[model samples]
Target chain A: MNGISAEQLNQAHQADLAIQSEEGVVFEHAWADPDEGVIYCLSDAPSAEAVMRIHQRAGHPADEIHAVPLEV
Target chain B: MNGISAEQLNQAHQADLAIQSEEGVVFEHAWADPDEGVIYCLSDAPSAEAVMRIHQRAGHPADEIHAVPLEV
Candidate 1:
């Protein structure tokens, strides 16, 4: 996937306002493995720390959360 | 993601030789949703019909399996 631009991230953050109100925080893309049962996702939060907080609050704590761009 | 080329699919089928020996057939990319508990994947099977057959045998049959390329 192309790297998300700062402007895009900002827009995503703005768009997530509604989701944040309901789901707490919305991840861009999230998926889990059937066999391994591991979930992975990309979130546009204020910071990597915020991403972890979101996951923690969701009760599905991430096994690994990286502050990196997702490559397709 | 780029569309799987006929040659790439052929190579993948050949490379999956080892997996087919054990797991029956291998999918290219697969993911599931934790909350939704739905799985999605890309498979380069002999035919669309074959793709469904693989999923049926896997037990967690697909809810929607399209014969379209996955866009990253």
Candidate 2:
């Protein structure tokens, strides 16, 4: 799939918001293989905007920021 | 940070074996926000042990599996 389904995207967005609210800045992130069509991320900042800035500075902006719940 | 400092978890396990050798069965994944730690993922299942058996049947079993690189 070239793009994720709307429902999936919504879930991802919600997760992102949750993370942003908690973390503040996100500095790392990634997306799935096109064939598989998914997304993920990690960050070191305190805000989502900061994370986005990092991506922009790195010359690779993110398409989405997914909230990853850790087992640890 | 609760964890995630050993060279950023070895570049997130080398991007999770390069997305499990190009998407082999990763249902979905995420990690981070632990005081700005880092990790992320997304999948639809093709390999990686069927995305680790869908996280051991969705019971939450994933210490790490991050290789998210997407800009589209």
Off by more than 4 A, model 1: A1-26, A69-72, B1-72
Model 2, first chain, TM-score of: 0.39
lDDT of each: 0.47, 0.49
Compared with the true structure, what per-residue lDDT tens digits does model 2 show for residues B1-72?
356554554455445545453435643443454455544445655455666655545444566543333432
Across A1-72, the per-residue lDDT of candidate 1 in tens digits comes to 134444543444445443454444556654333233334465656665666665555444566554432211
**Candidate 1: count of backbone clashes, pairs at least 3 residues apart or interchain:** 2
Q: Given candidate 2, what's the lDDT at residue A1? A: 33
CA lDDT of B51 in candidate 2?
67
Estimate the TM-score of every prediction: 0.34, 0.33
Which number leads on lDDT?
Answer: 2
Per-residue CA lDDT of model 1 for B1-72, tens digit only, reads 134344543443444343442433557654333333334465655655666665555443556555432211
